[model samples]
Target: MRLDKFLKISRIIKRRTVAKDFAEGERVMVNGRIAKPSTDVKKGDILTLRIGDRETVFEILDIKDNVKAAEAKNLYRIIE
Candidate 1:
């Protein structure tokens, strides 16, 4: 799945446009490298999102086109 779509479908960013903007602005990274909105995302890939000064890292566990609110968190595993 596209990185932007994955973020929205996974409910990580809430909206696809916001996710695209984040990716375009270089606020999102995949496997430790800056990624664009069209970047491909797959299982086991590490993703890091910068929100202000804080960084949120996660490992992609699965990819789904649509997910229920209750199941959204299953798409990725948070890294501490």
Candidate 2:
């Protein structure tokens, strides 16, 4: 899945456009390197998101196109 799509589907960023903005601003990283919204993401990949002074890390556990709100967290495991 694309980074932006995953962010939305997993309910991490709430909106795909917001996720794209975050990536365009260079606030999103994958596997230690900065990533773009179109960047491909898959199981086991590490994602780091920085917003202001806060940072969150997650490990991709699964990918799904459509997921229930309550089940979104299952798509990624928070690492921080």
Candidate 3:
């Protein structure tokens, strides 16, 4: 799935547009490399998100076009 979509579906950033902005501004990374909003994300990929002075990491567990709010957390596993 696209990085922005994945982020929204997984409830990481709450909205696709916000995720896109973060990716476009170089605040996100995939597998240790900077990634764009359109970047392809897949299972097992490591994602790093720079939020102010904190860095959050997650491992993609699954990808889906849609998911319920209760199930969103199942899409990725927090690493830190």
**Which residue pairs clash in candidate 2?**
none
Which parts of model 1 have CA positions greater than 4 angstroms off? none
What Cα-based lDDT does every candidate model obtain? 0.96, 0.97, 0.97
For candidate 3, write residues 1-80 as lDDT tens digits: 89999999999999999999999999999999999999999999999999998999999999999799999999999999
* Cα lDDT, model 1, residue 52: 98
TM-score of each: 0.98, 0.98, 0.98
lDDT of 2 at 34: 99
Per residue, candidate 2 scores C-alpha lDDT tens digits across 2-80 of 9999999999999999999999999999999999999999999999999899999999999999999999999999899
Q: How far is candidate 2 from the true structure (C-alpha RMSD, Å)?
A: 0.5
- Give candidate 2's whole-model lDDT: 0.97
- Which clashing pairs does model 1 show? none
